[model samples]
Target: MLLKLDLTDSRPLHEQVAGAIRRAIAEGECAPGDRLPPARELSRALGVNANTVLRGLRALRDEGVLEFRRGRGVTVLAGADQRARLVDQAGALLAEATRLGYSRADLVELIRRLP
Candidate 1:
């Protein structure tokens, strides 16, 4: 998997790691049932701590984009491509709303008001 972190990005390292993996999934770098490189391997490649990589992986798993299996490693989940895309879009929306001085609750309200 090709994971790229923007050194200029101000987000937390773990978030950057997660974003990179999310992008990889959205771009088809890996597919459902595909095993991911170990956290240590990813940390070495990204020059971050292994814990940071694991945290990122956990975040992806929480978002339903990846799955963790005992002795089987991490695998991309089915429909991950679409899930990743929605995550990207939601992140963009949140960023825009924050920039516009709207709180997350306000964003939620806006969505609720939508048809």
Candidate 2:
């Protein structure tokens, strides 16, 4: 999977990395049981610290989206279809919000207000 990170963005590198992986999984770029690149390799590719990549991987692991094994590397979990649906819905929401002149933060705030 290819991940793009914007250093100028306010979010931390770890969070951005995690988010990128999440989106990739959610968009069906990765299916369940697929193993991700080793943390050190991913870190090298992204030009970030290995620990940063590990932190992102661990965050996904904590969310049950990935499994870390001693020598098998990190594996994608099941429930990809559900995640894809969610990502599609989120995209639709964002598109509509933009059409309505709302920024991403505005859409998030509006969603937060929903009961």
Candidate 3:
């Protein structure tokens, strides 16, 4: 998955990194057992500090979406079950948006605007 960050975004860089990874998992762009890029490499790609990448990876690990193996770098732990849960949550979010008078297109547009 290619990680993208909006430098102008108000959120912290680490949070942005974590969010992109989470979205990748949710969208099935990443699967269980996939190995993530090394922290230093990812940092270089994202033009951020290695510590920032490490922080993002740690957050994913804490969320059970990734695991750090001794010699395997960070491996994805998210699988079909995780994807299903994400779908359910997204459904709930869409329902709420509908209740708030947002159309499906509106929801899609909003999501498209996300980094």
Candidate 4:
């Protein structure tokens, strides 16, 4: 999955990284046991620091959504249970977006613009 970044966002870059990865997982772009890109590569792709990528991956690991491994980089943690948890996470995000004045059309536009 690709992480399309918004450079102007007020949120920290690491959080954006984490949020994109989380969205990919939640939406089934990446699935159980899928390998994530290495920190340096992901950092380059997103135009952020390698450390920032790692920090975001670490945050996901702490949340039980990803696993960090030596040499192998990050991997999705989803099995059946984890997938269910991710769906809940997605639902919560969607609800929050709605609460914050995001319409379905807005989300569709955002996804449509992702590279």
Best by lDDT: 1
- Top-TM-score structure, candidate number: 1
Query: Could you tell me the lDDT of residue 65 within candidate 3?
Result: 78
- Per-residue accuracy of model 2 over 4-78 as CA lDDT, tens digit each: 889998778997898788888987888999999888989999999999999988887887778888889899988
What are the per-residue Cα lDDT tens digits for candidate 1 across 57-98? 999999999999999999999999999999999999999999
Summed over model 1, clashes come to 0
* TM-scores for the candidates: 0.98, 0.72, 0.70, 0.69
- Lowest lDDT 10-residue stretch of candidate 2: 80-89
Candidate 4 worst ten-residue window by lDDT: 78-87
User: For residues 40-101, what per-residue lDDT tens digits would candidate 4 score against the true structure?
Assistant: 99989888889998898888888788887888877887562355466456657776888899
Ten residues in sequence with the least summed lDDT for candidate 1: 1-10
RMSD of each: 0.6, 4.4, 8.3, 9.3
User: Among all windows of ten consecutive residues in candidate 3, which has the lowest summed lDDT?
Assistant: 79-88
Candidate numbers, best lDDT first, in rank order? 1, 2, 3, 4
Candidate that beats the other on lDDT, 2 or 4, i.e. the better one: 2
